[model samples]
Target: MLRVRQWLFAASFFVCGASLASTACPNFFVNGSNPSIDASLTTRTTEVCHTEYVLLASGVTKGPLYSAQHITAAQVAGADSISRTGSFHQETAIPAADRSQTSDYTNSGFDRGHMTPAGDESTIDSEKESFSMANIVPQDHKLNTGEWAKIEAKVRDLATNLGEVYVVTGPAFDPDNTPTIGKDQVAVPQYTWKAVYEPGKGAAAYLCQNDDSITCDVVSLNDIKTLSGVDPFPALSSSDHANPISLPLP
Candidate 1:
């Protein structure tokens, strides 16, 4: 059936080493556009064997970047157990006063949403490391668990189907109208965007409103830059790609 075919694709991809050439990890910022609102923020980059992540440090919060892994059926089957091993924690690599904490999300009405979902990680250690504060943002509870979550799942599906995929996802803020939560005043993003890319398939970009109501669009990379004010995956921008079709939330 379909499951067998998927497993066969996964096995063949790993066996022939075909995935390695096309799925190289990407850099933190696409074309030198930092995600910080203030000048004082620091940036941190991390490598976890099969994954690469970057933390663009802001005063109270940081933005994280991760490329989705070319996962196998075995990894997918064991993901749940690995994910349960650790909880979110502050990243010690940054100064204590600068990093976000679990306390910052306490009663903040928003969730400590992960830019890189645990599902995309190939190992337990990588999944645990994903809990670092630098990889989180103040996300609306509804959207965090809703359409955004759906998109994360879709990325995983793409990883399985395309053999390899890289995704750039993070928060987008309107500086003039920024919102804050908790005592540390972590900024809540007004919008969030994700761009999914495969070697031969070009790329698809998504934008979500980050609110209770589910409003999102799949748009061109050009549109994504205009809406989010950041250019993601600049190298792939000129690839032959189709425009995004709208998705209506049920």
Candidate 2:
């Protein structure tokens, strides 16, 4: 029954997009990329410890991969979720290769929290894909499912306001590669994110490493800044990653 309702929601969203094809795609990015922008094509898959993470095509696993969509869906800031998953850029995460091996579970017990979330998706299929195990990981219950999810929801609203722009999100690495787990059920790392937004640009980005949450981890927003002054969408530069300042709105 729940599955049927979800599919119905997804189908309706698809119809709405097709119905509103005349709407324009907006773009927003204040200023420009900082001089130190890494330009490493942050859009592609990146590793979050145990292994660099990337979106893989259905039924295909291993090696280099990218999400199903070249673009990511972003929402605007608001008290509630504005544009949910129907935007459809969100993708699922893959499971660890081996749990027995610490290195295999390199992200041992780490949750594969999404840069973009399924609940934030605008359509049902988009949301369904989010449920795929490929896009999951052991997460710190607190961060992955709580506040962090809130930020993901805001990104969707931000995108709704801006129109269209590039987005690239993943985890914030601790040069040392350390992932912290929650009370045997959640994972909490240095940070989780929904980075990227041009205020007026409909585009935004998100990134987060998995932790140890039995369910999805929920980290609240502390309003972290994007000190890099460059877009992590195309690629985050070493300098930008190193210089994260304050979030634009906060």
Candidate 3:
């Protein structure tokens, strides 16, 4: 029954390129429009573009508000041919005061989670760039290695099967009592989310709490906007924002 509804939505929906202004790395986004963060979330931000992805790094959070990527089946195949470097470093492109240091996550009891997974990068340069701290957040070790890992793999599989997909990933902090870590005071998000747009098909997001409990859900894009204060896909039609296509979960 759910599959029927999803197929119907896919059959009827058509996504057109948005005419919004382009970012420094416009190709990474669905319609060249970078994800916009609400002023209340954080006022200071820098746009950092990498070889394979682009992100909005927040000075207040000392991490990425969101990272965007355009993935293709051929890219996934190439990424699979490479080896994991596990090389993590601070992004020199971001202002020193606003960026997180490797030391900030050291002994802080959190993993430096990548908004765009290393496995998604096809070249050695891109894989290394994936390690930049600007694309990272202080995430729970258990959640990062467990369910979140599964989610990343699932998206990669989707790219392999769907030919192409646009992805935006980021964190959501609690307004009143956000936690901080290390000397830089890097903010720890309460929840992390990954939104996927299968062009001409449908869109949906996987949202999970950054905790040992590993709670997660498949939600509408509007739900993500309401919770995170960022509309990841501003170009998608209102109906697409309101409706969530079913996604296979691990």
Best by TM-score: 3
Model 1, span 30-126: residue lDDT tens? 3333221221122333322234344444553344433233344444555644545659987776565666778888887888888777766667787
Q: State TM-scores per candidate.
A: 0.72, 0.41, 0.90
| Per-candidate local distance difference test | 0.58, 0.34, 0.84
Return whichever of 2 and 3 wins on TM-score. 3
Which regions of candidate 3 deviate over 4 angstroms? 1-22
Which wins on TM-score, candidate 1 or candidate 3?
3
lDDT tens digits by residue: candidate 2, 1-250: 2432333334332221101001011121123221112223223323221111123221212211122222234322221343343322222232333111122224454545454356544444445444433344344566666656665555455446555333334333232343443222222333344445343323333433333332222121111222111223333333443433333321
RMSD of each: 11.7, 15.6, 6.8
Better of 1 and 2 by lDDT: 1
Prediction 1 TM-score vs. true: 0.72
Off by over 4 Å in 2: 1-112, 175-190, 199-231, 235-250
Q: Candidate 1 regions off by >4 Å? A: 1-52, 60-83, 237-250
Best by lDDT: 3
